[model samples]
Every structure is written in C-alpha cells, then in structure tokens.
Target: MTNTILGNISFENLAREKAEYPRLHMLKPESFKHIEIKNFEKVEKEISFEIGYHRGRKRWCLDIYTHRGIRCDGEIKFFSSIPAIREFIRKEYQREPILPAFNQKSATSNFNI
Candidate 1:
C-alpha cells in the first residue's frame, strides 16, 4: 500500500528499471527543520543522492525524491547497518551522468568579441 505522496514503486522495482536517479531539489536550511532527529548525521549529500542516519530508528535512510515518476516526500529506504547502506547505495545509485556536462570550450568558440 502506498500513499498519495509516495507512489507504489518499491526500491526493488526501481533497481530493476533502467532509469537513473532523479535530480535533487535545491535544499534549504529549513529542509532539516521538519526532520527532527537528534543524533543523525548526513553521511552522503549530492546533487541527487542523500544518506543519513536516524539514531532513534538505528537505521540508515536515503531520501526518496526522484523526477523519474518516483516522487516521495517523506518516504525513504532504510538499511540495517553502515556496510549494508554503503553497498546498497553503490549498487543502486550508479554514478552515471544524468545530464551532459557543460563544455566551456564549445560555448566560448561561438562568442564574438
């Protein structure tokens, strides 16, 4: 069962698909305001990936925000151990270029003085 905010696609379903991770929404300082966790540390933070620990839950969780039809606000994938979380992230979150890098040379070539 899934809620309206988080769709029905589980982590397993996502692993099977060929889609890459989604683009991240620009996080503001207020983003952590709602996530009231005491001993939590943001272990990983990237443009589209984030991993944090919830001391109370004793679990490592990754954010479930994606542009690829997997939009979830508060939903997350939790892991039991640090190793498990690391390995899972390595396998699932393949560091692939979702968008082409900006080529400065090409852009500058077209500029007229």
Candidate 2:
C-alpha cells in the first residue's frame, strides 16, 4: 500500500487532504488524511477513517472502511459542521491515534499524540 505522513504518523494508501478542524487544532488537516485502525470481525482486522468535506454533497463526512468491529463497521457518516466533526474525532480518538512508522520517519514530531 502507499504511505502518507500525518503529523508524525504514517498512514498507508491515504493522502492528506486540504481542510481544517479548528477544534482539533493539534491535528493539522494537511498532515493526516485517514485514521488507521484495527478491529475484530471474525478475527482481527484493519481499517481507516477518511474525514473531510464532500464537495458534491457540500457537507462534512467521515468514511470508515476495510473492517467490521465494535468501533468501526465500515460506514460513512455525515456531519453538518466542523464542531460535529471535531466531536466525532475526539470521540473516536479518545487518546490520539498513533501507529508504528511505516518506512521512514515523519518530517515533524511536534504532534502531542
């Protein structure tokens, strides 16, 4: 899979999109595109969260994909404003999401999480 940097973490096959979530100020919109996660279906599984503006729909949406589990069930949920998105981000990422370095180190290490 392709790899992209998000703050100090590297996500596979996801590109950082141009957007901003002021509530989630620590998380720069440009650095991280998707949230890489693992879950359990019949067994352990991996997935991602794609959060951004839907140009066609003209709304904010969160796409959870590639797995089925307690938290991520491969669904697309929409929101009306940045505050809603921020709440969701904070909910899903209670303590911040971090993954092992994929291939190379990220350019920045200032991310608190």
Candidate 3:
C-alpha cells in the first residue's frame, strides 16, 4: 500500500467531508471488514487515525491505527461531535498501543490446543 501523507490535504476540507458525507472506513486489504461512521474525528494538525482489520487465530479484531504507527485494538467508542473525536484522537495518539501482529503468530501456533 502507498503511504499518503495527511499533511497534503486541508483539514477543513477533510473535516467537512467527514462530517457531511458519512462513509464506511473499510479495513485495509479490502477483504477484512467494513466499519460505518456517521461522524468522524476531524482531521487536524499532527493528528490522524488509520482504520484496519486484524486477524487472530480464533477471531478477528478491528483496530484503529494511530499516526504514531501503533494500533489500538478492540471495539472503538465513536463520537458524534467532531471536537470529541478530535480530543480522543489526541489522547490516544499520546498513549499509542502496540499492533496485534506481535501476538498473532503465537496465537495461531497454539490454536491446536
């Protein structure tokens, strides 16, 4: 996949589109899963979120990939207001979670038990 910098676009345009035109942020690889969001975190300086699907041995996890390259696993509590989502993004970016890939292979290897 290509890495597109969010810095190339205007935040106002992204925010307006995210607010007015709700869309499903499909996980990467296209076949993983689809998540619908009526309202999304408004894009801002030094802040961005990535949506992707993670596969485990027994189940799949929907993860939010942060700008810091950390993936926050499990269910996400979405916010309807732009400001709220923005704040969540800020805080989450600070405490970035490790990507599930670290444990994926181990989980599958031990699945026969």
Count of backbone clashes, every candidate in sequence: 0, 1, 0
Rank order (by lDDT, best first): 2, 1, 3
Q: Show where candidate 1 strays beyond 4 Å.
A: 1-47, 68-74, 96-113
The whole-model C-alpha lDDT of candidate 3 against the native structure comes to 0.31
Model 1 TM-score relative to the real fold? 0.32
Residues 57-85 of candidate 1 have per-residue lDDT tens digits of 65555654433234333457777643554
Query: In candidate 2, which residue ranges exceed 4 Å CA deviation?
Result: 1-45, 66-73, 97-113
- Residue-wise lDDT of candidate 2 within 12-106, one digit each (tens)? 32235532221121233222333444463234445466565555666666666654345545677888853565577668645343422323334
Each prediction's TM-score against the native?
0.32, 0.36, 0.25
| TM match of model 3 to true structure | 0.25
Best by lDDT: 2
Better of 2 and 3 by lDDT: 2
Worst 10 residues of 1 by lDDT: 1-10
Model 2: colliding residue pairs? 2-13
Cα displacement (Å) at residue 46, model 3: 17
